[model samples]
Target chain A: MRSQSEPTQSAGKRAAPPYEQIKLFLKERLENGHWTPGALMPSEADLVAKFAVSRMTVNRALRELQLEGLVDRVQGVGTFAAQLHRVSSSLTIRDIHEEVLERGHVHHATVHLAKAESASATAAQRLGVGLNASVFHTVIVHYENGVALQCEDRYVNPECAPDYLSVDFTKITPTHYLLDVAPLWEARFAVEAGLPTAREAKLLGLKITDPVLIVSRRTVNRGVPITQARLVHPAGRYQIDGVFKP
Target chain B: MRSQSEPTQSAGKRAAPPYEQIKLFLKERLENGHWTPGALMPSEADLVAKFAVSRMTVNRALRELQLEGLVDRVQGVGTFAAQLHRVSSSLTIRDIHEEVLERGHVHHATVHLAKAESASATAAQRLGVGLNASVFHTVIVHYENGVALQCEDRYVNPECAPDYLSVDFTKITPTHYLLDVAPLWEARFAVEAGLPTAREAKLLGLKITDPVLIVSRRTVNRGVPITQARLVHPAGRYQIDGVFKP
Candidate 1:
């Protein structure tokens, strides 16, 4: 670990504020695993002397890092590196295929159903269409490293993407295809936990009574509804994580 | 229902944009229960004629409403009122007692444990304290309408709030008190579904095999660790909802 006695290598070359430079120094130690999670960090006084900066500067750097969820400081005890958690921003729309690939895991899908159908009352309500409107429906199961991860049932508004029936879903997910053709203008979603239906259980190879994490989403483009989807995953296998700035 | 033939009564007096006016018109209808969920909404042509505005104006109104989860739109079919779901932004921290009161339900809490003790390895890691450091621990169950709603287990770093043990929990929740004394600077959380532990199930009055929704949260203030908390709710009773803009 870089200590207070370490030489001040970049004293005059940097134009950034003292606090910012101190933050970078601390960040590098954390990122490089020199400062492990739960390990005590250098005291403000130590940092101030090492960087030849004011105590306020060191305090500001540490405070900013804490606000970013990067470190945790105790009043009288001292600051310590925070344990890293799965952090996801609610504003970002994540692609499951991309997520799996990023983790260096193989991704595959099994298409169960894909066809054009008259919208049911529930589907009609969610898709913002008149009763019996033509809508495309598809059901697919996604796998990561050969383990079932998600069961997706989606309803697409035909007016938004008339070519929905012709596309091969096995190669490209409905989400990817829609984003390519229609693009998302806005979205709303809800997350809940519940027992899976018999059919859903059978498809996911889970017991009927087993719990599942359910995510319901609706997306719109321009001034038109594009799609509504229900995503289900086995309990204990998936989580939705996030960070909040107050 | 207001029809296309209705005169635009406020046209000359209202200074808002045409689309904003149209949006308010639709919103009032939905809020007053004049239009029920799943009911078909007026078409764009109908809205344009009714508001005496261009088609683009009405389209923008409906599109914005759909993005807000107030309505659903279908391409050749027609727009319809959306079913209301629990929607929350991850950025906001919610108070469970206030949440229950907002639903017009009675809220109460049962305190199980409140004391100061040495931090365990896991607690120490989460709170960024050293081994055997003094930490305050509390366990409480929140009830809504006489049914148990949540079991909260929390650990607080004494350095952040020294009076953690002396507070009257029945009169004031730990969370409420903490926020009052030590406002949060940042927070991270995760939502998962899992089976409750034996002790948790007993406290929650649930069967051992029943699923539960678990939320783990860690919050810091000014680069200092304040608290780490775990909240567990019955699977069918609670959810974490969000809206995302892309």
Candidate 2:
């Protein structure tokens, strides 16, 4: 039977720092089955005597435990041992280009359109520019291992980078090229579940009305508007996560 | 008028640490118009003469700049100052209860169903438990500010926590109560976009066939089969993100 107490690491009878001793002591107890999840532990005074440490040292160790979500302290009630909640720090959203390269798969891009176009009201408001302004537009399809994975529909403010069309995007991805040209100032993002139209579904090699993941990001570069891109990915193989420091 | 050759801080600084000086030197030159986006930068040899520093130091600085998305380098071709492409971080999916708390809105959950039944094949496989074993199920509608915002359909394995039904869930959130009792071990997640059924939509206060964001998570507790939860939110107000150190 596993104990609920934190495992304590005993330091050989040499003088160890009070804080470290207490941390190890609690850790071993937790691991050795003394304190179980939701089990209230001894009071601060009790622990101070048990560890031959001052209240402040015990408090410091407990404080760290609380921060790590290993224990919950309630007013008037003693601290209780918490169940181990593994908050993973490994989740990440990688750029498609990087992801493809990392998988040792061949990456190819086809830029169907790259030219200046008049902006609609939605585009203008999104770019924070005037209506009908010349906006640089690009329609790109990215493929991995000969399968199309994403369709990037993008709009850029011409005033932000006037020579947008001059660069060849064949060798580098739009994300790679833009990051090189424009330093990102700020960004806004949204994600939604949507059904792709016949055209979008065809491009993604999926059936019509299949559930799709749509990610939209609006970026501002320098003092002018940079670009807004809509990335469409199939839902079966994608998930995103980030850490929170409370 | 910003001139591509306008210099500011990079001029006449030769005594500082080479990397720091080079970074600032490039920054000022870029800011003052010496190096506009897409403009070819001077070769390492040229920078070596300009700052009287080793090529290695200049190379280190340029490498950092490249990683920061400020410059592009081509084999046998010169380096070019790149446009600022915005770097967007991945999003954190907030629990519905947490989101309501963040908005300072009152949150309430109306439990639609809570019962124990023999685990179905699908449920057993998902929970990694024996088929036909007892399992707990819960269906809940979450309201924020008196508006229905989410529907949570969850299932739990009774072997992981026998006292689950004995607790009153109306006064405490399932998440809070479960966290207090059993700590989460590992989680698998999936996200997709879909239209909800008429009943689900009504429960969430969403229009029929409206785009909805659905997230499913299966959590294990200390190697014991625990629970799986599916959460649906109105797409208009919900977003998901995952960030990584790339």
Candidate 3:
């Protein structure tokens, strides 16, 4: 591939810049699956020799790829193809199982706790129910391709979903089931960075000190609170992405 | 104050629940400036005696307040009124100074670094400039009422904002200036939770171990890359809040 001293003339057109050529070469390889995720590409010196360009040119190509989220470069370690982490915005409530499967990855859930419990004052107030009212509480750890991705702690008002406890959560996510039972009319959400509690850390398989991206959401159906959930994701593994107009 | 309770009948209505009455009482005190931020509230035992309710009711009331972000409950240290933290969402890009003033808080900026430098490989790629192209970089710490709220590190493409370095940043934030110079056409943003770098921690007056909420944004004008910025906020002090319809 390096033998072509002249940038391949597409119908005898002017050659693209050396850096652009190098970037396209690497991008094509990535797209063709020749270089799998986590596979290291050629070093700067190697790329320069192959492209017959200055080392700065090769560096610029790789840097652009890194900025585009295609590669990860460690100071001491060579550059490796990066696995793109999916970004979710709080603008839309998406079913995690569907999201995972849409990415061509396997999805599974481990139901840690699902039971009817007396609502704490906080839950009761948020749910607009009398204190100590029966509420269905469920905690599930969602895994994508066998790796834990989200820890969902949810409280469902018993009046909205009386059969919440009888559902087989492993087969269908609580989010899906709840949406079916109580169509969402409105929701208020807050996203924050927080250190996970010990139990949450253990369930997410994260370090106690590691920060987690927490999305606290309360959904209402017809002006009545149906469910409130706290979704936790490991900091390094997840991000929220959105686009906005002025 | 609690001697003639009878639920403190307002217009001789039915008495509110013990916890609801306590919640309202505390909320009134907080709103009327009787209890200031960070001021410790009466002990649970005191609340129980004052309301003529069980200890459980007082505990529940405080817990609810804590969950609502209105109070901080330290296990052994007691509950104290919490300073309301600001939350921003990616949906809209509001001027920080405007946001602070709207909240009745003073806003100020401390310009840390403002200079022209050759773009690093990363910046060059993100800004779509040639290798070693001149780029204007600025670092500013934004404060609200003398408390550091955000540390903004921004890189501007010289082609987009030629007068970037000449502007007095302390008087006008880079964000404000940039918005004026380049009317935002479109923007892409990603928010993540991570540990701050040493310089970011120092500038934000946060402990190195503390996590931060980071929002990385890249704005374009007529499909041309203009500026890329990383806005960092101390996790304990900031959150991102948003509402969306299905």
Candidate 4:
């Protein structure tokens, strides 16, 4: 059940503090049915008495457990184990190059095009720039273990990353370079499943009937629109995984 | 920017509280570049003095703003605006029928198959049941305004919902019925993009060249494995939308 997500990894590496031990101890009891879902948990005072810990320690333990969806708390009532009817999940999207290298695979990039262009109406709106504004555009194909994995088509606001076109894209990913130049403060994303365009299919060496996953994003930093990017991936090699417990 | 994501709707619907007013006032200033990201925000005491509000109110405003990705709080230093470098996004997977209706379209369901079957090895593992145990299986095609949108293939553990196969699927969604029987306590979800199988294409009335977004989820309730469902949507008819501010 413990895959790549965040809660337990750091908690496991540290020596057990009193609060951490309390949380784990209670979580174990709750999981083993010491209290059924929605059953009232012991009051803070009762827990303080039983564990011989400070009220703040018990409170912190309960607070964290609630945050992790292990328990639920109601105002003017006692804490209780969670009893959710709706599925809740969090997804963490990681960098492709980092993910590939962690899996012991080599990552390579092929630069297709990099140059300045006048923004189209759609591109201008997405980047919050005026129409016909000078913006940098780049098309790059990323490979994992020499297999075509992702093709990125991007439009960057000259104000956000002035050197977007000058950098050799074959040497550095546009995502890494852009992030280095302007930290992401806001974004909007949409994902569509579709067959790739003819140009995309040719670049990725894909069959005509192959499916592709497309993700488009618009990013903003410090009130400045940064970039608009569309990423395409072959379906056979990519999936987004998410896990939830509540 | 305000499409479907949280943080501002309720704050707008209700009359602005003192904290809400303060939050908006500061957010407007920040978004207009009165202060760059990472610049020190006014200290709590300073805010209270300037706004003539209580310290608690000012603190609440700052806290909520931080939670909304509009600000970042640093202990022992002043609060700062968000400075995220990575794109953060959230995808909300809602029921197809509800989404269709929300679009002012009609929804129809055609049940293809519904019966009890001996669990195969993979099905047994997915449902956490014994191999060869009885499990309920169903296949349904969903339509929005006469256009096929989703094909749902589901396997339900008999123990989790004893009346699963007896229900009238045409009248009720499997998801609604399952939640009524056993509230979802845990789930794992995987999303894949691919050309649908011949059978799936037929169910969705999609062409062989059409792509599909396939979302598979394993659900559990009260520590018992409940159901595993795979939902396939025609790429052209449906898309998953997500928005993020940081």
List candidate 1 stretches off by more than 4 Å: A1-93, A125-128, A221-223, A244-246, B1-93, B102-105, B125-128, B221-224, B244-246
* Candidate 3 off by > 4 Å: A1-93, A125-128, A244-246, B1-93, B125-128, B244-246
lDDT of model 1 at residue B38?
Answer: 72
Per-residue accuracy of model 2 over A1-246 as CA lDDT, tens digit each: 313332244567665666766776776666544777778888898887776666877887886667566678897999987765334222345577787898898888778789888898977876777889889888777888878877777888776667778777667776776666665645666777776667678778887656667887776644567888888876564445433221
Which digits, one per residue and each the tens of the lDDT, describe model 4 over residues A130-219?
999999888899999999999888899888788778898787788778766766657777777988878889999987579998888878
Best-to-worst order by lDDT is 4, 1, 3, 2
Pick the DockQ winner: 4
Q: Write the per-residue lDDT of candidate 1 for residues B1-246, one digit (tens) a residue.
A: 555544345556756777777888898777655666678999999887777777867887887788667788899999997654322123233567877897899989988999998999988987778889999999999998999989998999888789988998877778778766655546777777788888889999999789888877887855778898888888878775556442
For every model in order, what is the number of clashing pairs? 3, 35, 0, 0
Whole-structure CA lDDT of model 2: 0.70
Each model's Cα RMSD: 13.4, 11.5, 24.0, 7.1
Predicted candidate 3 versus true structure: per-residue lDDT over A1-246, tens digit per residue: 546753455667787888888888887776554665578888888887876888868887887777566778987779886543211111343567877887899999999999998999987876667799899888999999999989998899888888889999999988777756654545677778888989899999888999888888777655677788888988888777666432
Tell me the tens digit of each residue's lDDT in model 4 across B1-246: 532311343544675767777888887777666766577888999887777777877887887777556688888988996644432655667777777888899988999999999999988987788899999999999888999889998999888789888899888889878766666657888787988779898888877678988888888755788899889989878887766752
Residue A60 C-alpha lDDT in model 2: 72
Residue A217, candidate 1: Cα error in Å is 0.8
Model 3 docking category: incorrect
The candidate maximizing lDDT is: 4
